[model samples]
Target: MKKLTNFTILSLFFFSGIMSSCKKDILETIPNDRVSSAIYWRTESDAIYGVNSVYSALDAVNLFVLDGVSDIGHTNTTFTVEFNIENGTYDASHSRIQTEWQNGFRGIFLANDVLANIDKITTTNTALLDRLKAETRVLRAYYYLKLTGLYGDVPLITNPITAAEGLSIARTSQADVYEFISTELAAASSALPASYPTAEKGRITKGAALALKARAHLWSGDFAQAAEAAKAVIDLNVYGLVDEYGKLFTYAMENSKEVVFDKQFLAGTLTHNSFAYMGPYSQRNSSSNFVPTKALADLYTMKNGKEITDPDAGFDPMQPYLNRDPRMRYTMYLDGDPLPSGILFKPVPGQGGADEVGKTQYNTSTGYSLKKYVVAEDLQTPGASGLNFILLRYAEVLLTYAEAKIELNQLDASVYDAINAIRTRPDVGLPELQAGLSQDELRKIVRRERTIELAFEGWRLFDIRRWKIGEQVMRGPVYGITYFENGNPVTIEVPSVTRVFDPAKHYIWPVPQKETALNPALGQNPGW
Candidate 1:
């Protein structure tokens, strides 16, 4: 899909202003200087632009920063708001908490505006109109899915409301919100095409809707429904695992078969600074804002699919990087690993490299740097990274199906097939999971696969929440890589702070204080 250009953004802003304007005298001459709904939303271009505007709210920065709040990743920059979340010190008034709420609603409002005004266009192509409405509904549902995932219960506003009504709106139950999302996605899936042309690659598809529905149901613990939804996506047969796991993230391989849906970007146009935040300090010439934790590294199984802690796994503490999962190298840069710039990544303290821990302000706190999504071009200009951030992928859908089936206790052949497909992907080539395993055993395998397969992709935090394992994983000291020091291996504490994940209050975020303060009807979450 082509990135939204400056012209499209300017046009969207113009239409947004017109949509927000109050009713004017109908008898008076329509002013050319301003556009109103009466004069707008009357063309194909109008509908397309309106829907495209809603896509802008998929903020790359906010989505990518989510990993920092999970066990897999850590935010090293203490000056940033996400660092507070990493340490579990954020509150209702936290800036990131407030923006997540505001941004979600902003997307919902844009979608609602499109849905409310789309009929104004008089087109004989009923198919086109239905597709546009379907797209808008899916987008709106996505925003609600995100909101409810974090906030538990949010005001489910499907229509454009007056300022007075907005101030008085009350929070809706999470169950009802999820039900609405499921219904919308199911209906939208039928109207959307199974695939789009290369020119329209990033547009939402039937698979996207089904994948999201599966995610929502799984998160809600509706295992049977989640499995069914995921199965529907698989049955479509329109997506498959990309041959090269790492290439799936590159600009050259974006919109590949593995990607069900992704946020689009183009260099010098709609871009983000992910490279600057996640890349090695040596390459980006800046401090890495986010770094992987040892907890994440420890999750990667040995090449033979044995746990690294296994006595037979042949893990060498002196050479920790050897004989580990290939994905570990693909996902993160360890000491002595060659970087994209062909320089060895040396994060050991006093190594005199920019990425060396404690070497300078522009150093990694965790002794490791992210390798995923760190394109070579982005390192040259770290602020303008055009790499598309994948929102949904076929691998995730497969894992969701396998997990839901395991939770449902179905234990069918399809479950093994789903997981083995990812395990034995061409580049990964890990040992296939054997069949006839007990449900509890399969459950552990699938969860571990999710952690390693989707690391640094912003799914760990949600997995921690949905699995109710926050207290176990989130409350502890975060550690970095183990390195040999004078013939002894020593694991260093990354941030020198103990994380606190209070199950009583940390499971769900409190309603942002600004929102609750503005609208008293929006009550605080429990134990906030």
Candidate 2:
């Protein structure tokens, strides 16, 4: 698959008239790079460039690091409010929360800009024009999805608006925003192709539109719509799980059949510091901002498909990391694990002949490092990781279908097949799910499958909130494993920090105070 280039992004700005100085008409303090509709959109290329800028609004770095706000991972630094969000200290003033709000609106504005002006381009190819419009609409709906998901009932700006007009628009209800997203995605999927050529691999596809539709519906608790959309993508038969479960996250096999949608990044031009944030600080000058917690590690069942709580499951506390799910090994770095860089990890660092966590402030607070999305090469090259942050994939589609079916009391052989496909993928092949389970039983199985399958991929945070399990998990002390002593692992559960999640307030993030100040009509969420 070909990577998106910075050259096109540069030309996008040029054609959009960012290079030309704009005369400030009544608008005071004109944005230096604001798009001027009167000066651009003269050709198909101009429309393409405008849409490309819309695509640029998504930041892979933000998507990945936001997982740190979830229970599976913890952020070490206080620079961002991720830790504060986790510990229940975050509010409307958090810069990260504000950035999430602003970035989504920025993308919405760019997408609307393209949609409002694409007809000005003289294109004989009606298909091209329709597809471009579909693409922009899909992207616009996506921005709305992000906005409403993060901040409930955000301002719905469907068209490019003047500065004065933007200041007065009130927040739209979440249901209305989701309704618009569903309508747009239905249109986009009809117009989009199932696949693109290698050079155009990152472009949105029919599968991506449906998959995102499934996601939007699932998030909104519309089980039937979510299941229908996900099953549609599955029936298309263009996507499947990668043979190696780990390869789904690596740069070598990017744009594989499993990847439905991803944010493309180039190694030298637009790389992320995921390794720096997620790797062990002892190796590769890692920042250790997002480290795995023992609570997450314990979520993976034993290879025999028995939970640690199961009486028959042979789980040893002394050697906690052994005989667990194969994905546990792939997704997290445990004590004494052999790293890809050819060194054995020491749990306590300096003591026990292991790498010391105290070597720098950028060390893991939980004594564990993230393995997914942080390849060995990323550690070797510092910031040269080009691994695309997968936004949607075939496994997620399958899981979404399974969850929706289970929730609707419609679990059947097809639901089993959907989950078993994910379980039986190569290298992580666990036992197939048995048939004739109760609806509640199947629901538990589906939820556990989602937790293990999508760990550290930025899904857990939303999953907990949607399932109404935030108070159950987030209002207690989080634990991590103790280091080795007397040549054996202590296996003690070291209390890290107690997290609080008020069921009423934490369920929805507060609308940024700045936003509410600018437009008082944009009322805050309850209990903010």
Per-model lDDT: 0.85, 0.79
What is candidate 2's CA lDDT for residue 130?
88
Count backbone clashes in candidate 2: 2
Tens-digit lDDT string for candidate 2 (1-528): 446545346545654564333566777454556555556777777766777777787657676556677777777654555778878898899888888888988888778777877898877887888887887788788888877877778887777788778677898899999999999999899999999888777778899999999999999999999999999999999998988886667877788899998878778776777776677766676776777776788788988889987888898767776688888888878888887677877656456433455455566666777788878767677666777778888999999999999889897899999999988888887899999999988888888889878888877877887898987877766566665677766543424556889988898899888988987878889999
Query: Could you give candidate 1's per-residue lDDT for residues 1-528 as a string of tens digits?
Result: 455444346555766557454556778665676567667788887788778877878757666688877888888777788878878889999999999899999999888988988998998988988998998899899999999999999998988999999899999999999999999999999999998877777778999999999999999999999999999999999999998886777888877889998888878877788887778878847557788899999998888999989999998888888877788888988898887678889988766765788777657888988887887767678888888889989999999999999998999999999999998888888899888899999999999999989888877888999999998899788899888778788788965678888899898999999988889999999998
What is the Cα-based TM-score of model 1?
Answer: 0.96
Model 2 residue 86 distance off true place after TM-score fit, in angstroms: 1.4
lDDT of 2: 0.79
Best by lDDT: 1
What local lDDT score does residue 349 receive in model 2, on the 0 to 100 scale?
48
